[model samples]
Target chain A: MRVCVLNGFDSEEMTVAQERKLEQELEVLNQKGDTVDYFKLRDRKIAYCLGCWDCWLKTPGECRIKDEQEDILKSFVKTDHLVFVSNVRLGFVTATLKKTMDRLIPNFLPYIRVYQNEFHHYPRYEKTPILHTRLIVDHTVERDEIDLIEDYFKRVALNFGSDLKSFKIIDGKGEEDYEFADM
Target chain B: MLICNGSPRGEMSNSATIAKWFLKDQDKVILLMKGPKHQEYLDILAAYDHIVFIYPLYVDAMPGIVKAFFERVAIADGLMAGKKVSFIIHSGFPESVHLEVLERYHRILSKKLGFVLADTIVIPGSEGFRLMPPKQNRKKQQDVMKLMDQFRIDQPFDDHLVRRLAGKRQSNKMRNFIFSLLEKTGITNLYWNSNLKRNNAYNKRFDKPYTEL
Candidate 1:
């Protein structure tokens, strides 16, 4: 299975111990033989979606802005499963991740379609991947915050026509507590 | 009242039109357009009795700029305890349920920030206003005035008005059938087709630029 991980937390903010745990999680995925790709948002330059609708009516399926996100978007769309790893800062995903979500407008056509009793922009591509949200939690996070993030992703799942597989919180603890579920 | 325009388009947004009409006297309302600058907003957040947020929904969530503002609020730089915060969220899709989750989230945030949630007004099919003429906005303007009259007295919007503004969530079977006929006639997509043709992108309207490498 193809897996893509989007890391929204700044690298400078992560401690070495947390980094080791993240590496262990990746090693587990690697040992399972799943094709894995990790995208650290800090390394790339991403622009906000201007809502121009050019990708819709003009250059269909492609954003006009020149940025590193073009390739990242490709991997995000083609993967079999998608993972969002972000430390809870303001009770949800970081602004970096939110900007990437805004830039994902190209994934859908401007044309509207009715699905599940609601109107949604039709997909530009045919396939939909499974979504997994792994939040890096801090002491500030409450049960309601976690549930709200999960609920938000369920909305994301519905929009992308993807199945919401799971939502988990990963603390600074060692990777021994983490296990790669069989895909 | 402070009116914060959270649309990515900033000033030239459909939400701006809604905001303009929603006000009884434009002078008393302060319009703050969301920009890259965040620190400027922090000082002004506490001074107002009421703050109105007008934004377009992106991917079933707040736009990145507005989300950043929410993050600022979450950080607790100011006291939001006594202020009344209201939202006027509009979306491209014609579904009230699509914005329902965010409304709940807003309610949660309201509680967390200790602000009074005035009302969460979700306007589905808001994008349609762009395609129509200026004359069509009069009714919405009047509706906005009536809402303000109620808000001035510290009252919430009537349920019937909210239902009316939200429009139909799902197109009924009969309407869907009629729309199919309209689609065949090219009337349903006339707005999009005309805009595409105006920009000389009509031929490439369905072009898929991204291919699997």
Candidate 2:
């Protein structure tokens, strides 16, 4: 299975030990015979969605902008599993992860459909992947904020047509939890 | 009043058109677009009579930049403690119910900053607002004026129009099939195709640029 790991933590806040642990976790995944592509979003160039429906109507399955998003979109569509690893920034997902999500309109058709008794956009691809999030939260993270994060991801899962398997909260010592995730 | 337009499309945005009506009083409201430049105005946000946030919903959430702005405001907590706030949220979805949780987020946000959430205007089907007929647009503008007039008297916005503005939560499968038929008949995509043709990018419309396929 193909997996995409998005580390939405910025440079200063991400500790070197945590980074290494993250790498170790990915190594374990690789050793288990998985194809994992990890991206540190802080070093990548991603633009905010302009609310232009070019990707929807004019261009059916792609964005016109010449950015790194095409690669991201391809990975998102091809993968069976997509993992979002983020540190809470001011009670929500880091801006990097949000930016990444904002640019995913290309994956959805402009046409609306009734899914699960709610109106949702039609999916461009044939199948939906399983979604999971590993949120690294600190003491400053409010309980309400975590709830908001869970709610936001649920909405994302709905939009992507993915089953949200789990949303695990981690500090520095919760690497063992990754073992239990569908990984 | 301080109006912050948080649409990523910047100044020339659907949010801007909605804002034009709300800022009808020329001398009172100052419109600011969300960008790095607005960070400098943090010092002045507290002094405004009220702050109006106009934004488009992106994937059931605020645009990333607007999310960033919210984080900054939270970091600078109490900067607008005594001020009141209002929200005008629009989206491409046909139903306004998609925006409910986001409204809850803002209300909680208001409480965090000690600001009052005076009113909220949630608009769905905003994609067609730009192409709306003049008479219909006039009526919508008038509806906006009624809400603004109430706010002018320092009263909150609790009008019957809220339900009307929300549109339908869902349509029957037959209507969905009809919409699908419209999509295939090219009626729904005429506007999009024309723009694509104008840009000389029509042939490339279905280009899968990055895929191995």
Candidate 3:
């Protein structure tokens, strides 16, 4: 399976030990025969979505902003499994990941559809990747905050015409307990 | 009082309309969140005892720019603590169910950041609110004005009024069927279709660019 890990970790907050553990986890996935592709979002130049309807109206499934996000958008639709890796901030994923998510409008059309008695956009592609979130949280985070994050991701998956296959919250210790094989 | 406009479109956004209408007389300065003035805005926000954050929902959550502002707030650490915060979240969809989880998140976020939760106002059918004719949106605007008039800076929204403003959580089967019929007749997508036609991309509306990959 092809897995795309979009890491949105803050460089200042990521500890050396946590960085090593992340590498070790990816290595384990590699040994397990999963084609792992990782993108560190902080290193790339991605602009915020201008809320311009150009992607939907003018360009048609293409964002007008000329930036590094085009490759990420292509990979997102082509991958078998897309993993969102980010450290929790303000009870949700980092803004880096959120900005990337906003730019993904090109994956869907400008039209609307009725699904399960609710309004949603139509998918532009024939298939979409299964979604997953691997969030790192501090001990101060509460159970409700975790639940809220899970619930929000579930809604995102549903809207994207996929299911949230897995959601893993990794603390500093016992990182080995959660494996990529589970995904 | 501090009012933050979290829409990427900045002042021209529909979220800005709500902010302007809500505080018509008092301070009318709406802080745009999509700019490079994060630290300056944070400094201004720290002095206010009450804050009103208005943003259009993007992908069923706060806009990325709004989340970016929250990240800065998280870093500030206690700068917003105990400040009464009210959120006005609007979305394009007519149903309020899509925004319920985000509203719940705001409730928990107040606790997490040590801010006092004033209220969360969810406005649906907000896609083209600013572009629509005033006569057509008069009733909806009146409803919001009534709600805002009753709003107390230090307290949560009135439960009865909040429920009324949210309209329906989800459409019933008959309503969905009617909407589907409208969609088939192409009345529901007039806004999108017109924009597509103007851009000359209406012929390629359903074009799938990434299918080959």
Q: Which candidate comes out best when scored by lDDT?
A: 3
lDDT of 1 by residue, B24-96 (tens): 4532433333454666776677667777888888888888777777777767644788687878888877667
Q: Arrange candidates by lDDT, highest first: which order?
A: 3, 1, 2
Fnat of the models, one by one?
0.51, 0.45, 0.85
Prediction 1 global C-alpha lDDT: 0.74
Candidate 2, residue A26: the lDDT equals 86
First chain TM-score for all predictions: 0.90, 0.92, 0.91
Q: Positional deviation of A78 in candidate 2, in angstroms?
A: 2.0
- Index of the highest-DockQ prediction: 3
Candidate 2 lDDT over residue span B114-208, tens digit each: 78787788888787675666466675666666776676667867577665666676566777678777867788668667887886767765555
lDDT of each: 0.74, 0.74, 0.81
Listed in order, each prediction's TM-score against the native is: 0.89, 0.88, 0.94
* Best prediction by TM-score: 3
Clashing pairs in 3: none
Q: 2 or 3: which has the higher TM-score?
A: 3
Q: After superposition, how far is residue A68 of candidate 2 from its true place, in Å?
A: 3.8
Could you give candidate 3's per-residue lDDT for residues A1-183 as a string of tens digits?
888888888665554455567778788989988888888888889998889979899989888998999888888777898888777777887889888989999999877888867888888888788998887877877788889889988989978888899998888563544467777
Candidate 2: docking tier: acceptable
Off by over 4 Å in 2: A14-20, A57-60, A172-176, B27-34, B172-174, B180-186, B200-204
Each prediction's total of clashing residue pairs, residues at least 3 apart in sequence or on different chains, is 0, 0, 0
Instruction: In angstroms, give how far residue B58 of model 2 lies from its true place.
Output: 0.8
Q: What is the TM-score of each candidate's chain B when compared with the real chain B?
A: 0.88, 0.88, 0.91
